[model samples]
Target: MSSVPKALKYSKTHEWVREEDDTVIIGITDHAQTMLGDLVYVELPELEFSFEMGQECAVIESVKAAADIYCPISGEVVEINELLLDNPQLINEDPYGKGWLLRLRPFENDFKELLTAEQYTKLVASEAH
Candidate 1:
């Protein structure tokens, strides 16, 4: 089973979002890291770069293959995890903590469109079937 922290909102694509004041902290979920296997490299979006919801903003490459990381909402990137440049495997170790990908200042009022923990769990379970 994959770890899904209840405090975070999730995308069907496996990104996690944590609300913090006006900004949202983002990261790939444990399920994502598990699926990707051992990570080798991470391509994070530039700081201050703006992207639309569902846009492909970065890439994560593992020994198995490369996977695109998508934006969960329209926003401007406020910060990125520079440590990943040195050790991308932090994603596999602590995806919800030190492995966080980026922070974003949202363009909209609510992130209600994002999935709740229960919903995301169901979504992942359905995918397994």
Candidate 2:
């Protein structure tokens, strides 16, 4: 089973969001990295670029395939994981921790509306069928 942190909100596209003081942290789920196989490269969004909710903001390339990473909420990208440029495998190692992708200053905390752990679990389960 994929590790879905109960504290984080998840997108249907498989990204996870963790709310901080005024900004939110983002990453692909454990399940995402597993499905992508061993990640080899990650193309991140420009720092300070603004993205709308559900917008494609980055690309993660793996031995298996390349997957697009989307913004879960409308926001300005305040920071990006530059280290991934040199070490994309960090995603496969610790996706919810050091593998985090970006930080966003959201227009609003609409992430509250995203799927919860239970909801996402069901979604993943349904997809497997």
Candidate 3:
């Protein structure tokens, strides 16, 4: 089973969002990283670049495949984890923590429409079958 932190919101595409003060941290889920197999590279969006919901904002390349990471919400990218440029392995190691891809200043704070931990868990289960 994949680790799905209850406090975060998840997208159907596998990205997770953790809300902070006026910003939200975004990253691929642990299940996503596991499926990707050892991350080799990451492509992050430019700071202050705005993206509409569902826009492909970044890319994650692993030994198995290169996956496009979509923006879970409409927002302006505020910060990116520069550490991933040198150590993409962090993603495979701690996806929900040190492996976070970027932080965004979302256009809004109401994330009720996104999937909860339970819903995401079910999604992952359904995909496995």
Candidate 4:
């Protein structure tokens, strides 16, 4: 089963976000990494890159397939995980922790479109079929 931490918010594209102070941290869900299978490459966004919610911000290539990562909220990217450049498999080992992709200083606090843990659980369950 995929881990869906209750404290974080999720996107339909299978990304998760955790708000911290003025920024929101973004990463793929456990289900995403499992579907992709053994990530081999990660293309991270540049710092200070501005993006709208649902915009394509990064890419991940796994042994099975390549997937585009969408920004969960509108903001300017302030930080990216440098560790993933050499260790993309961190995403498979720890999807919610050290595998976090980027941090964005959001444009606003409107997170009405994000899903709760319960909602995401249902989403994953529906997709299982």
Best TM-score goes to which candidate? 4
Error of 1 at 113 (Å): 1.2
Which lDDT values do the candidates have, in the order given? 0.93, 0.94, 0.94, 0.95
Give per-residue lDDT, candidate 1, residue 115: 98
The whole-model C-alpha lDDT of candidate 2 against the native structure comes to: 0.94
Model 1 lDDT-worst window of ten: 104-113
Q: Give candidate 1 regions above 4 Å deviation.
A: none
Comparing 1 and 4 on lDDT, the stronger one:
4
TM-score of each: 0.97, 0.97, 0.97, 0.98
lDDT of 2 by residue, 1-129 (tens): 999999999999999999999999999999999999999999998999999998999999998899998889899999999999999999999999999999999998687769998999999999899
Clash counts per candidate, in order, are 0, 0, 0, 0
Please give the RMSD to the true structure for each candidate, in Å: 0.7, 0.7, 0.8, 0.6
* Candidate 1 accuracy as TM-score: 0.97
lDDT of 1 at 95: 92
Model 4 over residues 25-127: C-alpha lDDT tens digits?
9999999999999999999999999999999999999988989999999999999999999999999999999999999999998688999999999999999
- In candidate 4, stretches whose alpha carbon ends up further than 4 angstroms from where it belongs are none
**lDDT-based ranking, best first?**
4, 3, 2, 1
